[model samples]
Target: MKATTARGTIEAGDVGEGRPVVLLHALALSGRLFDPIAAEWAPRRRVITPDARGHGGSDWDGRPFTGEDMADDVAALIETLVGGPADVIGMSMGGSTAVLLAQRRPDLVARLVLADATADYGPDRVQTWAERAEKAVNVPREKQVDFQIDRWFSPSFVEANADEVRRVCDIFVVTDSAAHAAACHALGTVAAVGELGTISAPTLVMVGDEDYATPPAMAEQLAAGIPDSRLEVLTATRHLSLIQRPDVWPEIEKHLDA
Candidate 1:
């Protein structure tokens, strides 16, 4: 389905019933990436998954997108669709968006799950991200997928999950270069660690021990900054731990219940 937000229109997959739980996806992926996790939660709570602008069925405004803009889109979705505050679980870019959402509209977020996200990439890493953005925008689409998969998953996992890797690559192939470029810029520009102290919602910062993009060290800093927060490290997983390790859901479930 689609929801009209103040910024533009967003495509979403809303399922189940009861307390609302919104799942945000990473860059170059759509709401469909949450199918496995959403199905698990659907039996107990309402799971809302929305494609970030320019990624899926959502409309792209033909401008560079920001953390604030993406955050507003989620806030608007919660307001118009869920009709109230909702628990949010976001990974990668979505995780950054969730952090911004809690910072900008604490009233709209009941609980927060920041998976593989960072509050700040700092000057050095931000520069690195900018360089990556430049390369991503110029590289051939196939090489782009190869570059991203190398960073997003561990080598062994990639070797073992060819079909899954190809499925994800398909999504990356269709992603608008403009939108992807904008998302990369947003990551480099985000510096919200100081603001994280003001977030009042109970937060869980989870990261894969093997995640190089947003490593456990970053998650440690993120958990430390938030007053009511804890950090969990999933072993043997890379950037996309939720997809890499479904066994971790029990731990996530326990955290959500708390």
Candidate 2:
């Protein structure tokens, strides 16, 4: 779970014991966000969820970063641990990093699951995200919690599972805003779409029906680009579908187990 980095020893919480699978988390969130979902992938498959560079417990180098840089790190993680290729699942911004890894070093990615991610983060989206991050930095932590809930969860889900939703929001508020802005910039100039079809991985593009962040349209766009890929939509869920709707894992399990 720990890898020696040029900067320091980076840690990733790993579990399960089958084919190696790497879990990349979303923007404004750390790898710990995957713990709940990681359980389903474990006990049968080896799942390694790392705190993305500059997020979670990982030391920030104070360097401006990009998704491509994160992708390069992941490709190396796979090569070092698995000795070659491995299946990768990325959620939200993590999905962008996943694709970048596959495209830049196809030999390191065996299969890809892009969940709640979009290829083109246009100017508008980047600006909005950047503005939001800017607004969040100076605001009190309490307000940041409210903002995350509104953007990432459905009202009904939050009402029914307020405590659980709060924990997810807590993670968001404590995350470094600057790191998020850097990732936003990375996605804004993202260019991995062209080589998607070249990916040999048996891929799955997943989204939640109630996901407001990246809707079904985005998932469909991914399926169209990744040759022979399939799409799975989790119902009655929001942006964090994997955590909000537990049923989503069976499909993911099927993908990994297959």
Candidate 3:
């Protein structure tokens, strides 16, 4: 259903009834990306997934943004619908937002699952991200997504799971370039490393060993920075391991369900 929040009309779903557990989608994806996962958890937790502004059915609400701004959007939704604290799981860009949610609005989160996100982006990384984003916003779409896709999946993943890669590739291609660009710009500005040690919630950080976009080393840095957190490396998978690997969710269920 659509509900007005601090940013705009926030598109969200609540499929179960219990302590709230919000799932945050990655940069190019909408909450729809979590439909399967949400269904799996619906028997117990209140699985709420919102299409981050400018994504899915939600409004673009326009322009330059940051991870903190995205977290604030989530905070507004929580206050309006959830009534109290909720457990949050964020993947990719969403994972970065989860960290901001913990830092900016601590009481809104009871616990957090940051899957494949990082708390640091040095100057070089920031510049590269900014350049890519700028191209998305202005440049033609000739070969924009090529480099990105290469960075996202390993050669073996593409070779072994050609079918799965094609499906995901279709989804990625359909995403709007402007929205993708804005999120890319936003990610470059977010620095959660300074506040990582202050996260008071139980946190779980996971990554795919073959994930090149945000590799296991970056995920390790996230785990190392957080005072109380664990780093898990799912073997034989790429950036989208949670979706690509068949047996990954059972282990994920342990941490998310607990």
Cα-based lDDT for every prediction: 0.86, 0.77, 0.80
lDDT of 3 by residue, 125-149 (tens): 6787788788876765536566655
- TM-scores, all models, native as reference: 0.95, 0.91, 0.90
TM-score: model 1 vs. ground truth: 0.95
Candidate 1 regions with alpha-carbon error over 4 angstroms: none
How do the residues 1-258 of candidate 1 rate in per-residue lDDT, one tens digit apiece? 988877678899999988888999998789988888889989988889999988889998778767888899899989889778999999999998999999999999999999999878776857877787787679877878877887788889899999888877888888877778778887777788899898999998899998989989889988999999998898888998788888888777777777
Winning candidate number (TM-score): 1
* Steric clashes per prediction: 0, 3, 0
Model 2 lDDT tens row, 1-258 = 578654355568778888888988887788788888777668778888887776777766767676688888777677666778888999888898887887788888877888888776654866766676566456766667776677677788889988788677777777777666666666666756667777777888888888878788888877888886899887766677667767667878788667
Q: Over the full model, what C-alpha lDDT does candidate 1 score relative to the true structure? A: 0.86
What C-alpha lDDT does candidate 3 achieve relative to the native structure? 0.80
- Least accurate stretch of 10 residues (summed lDDT) in model 2? 1-10
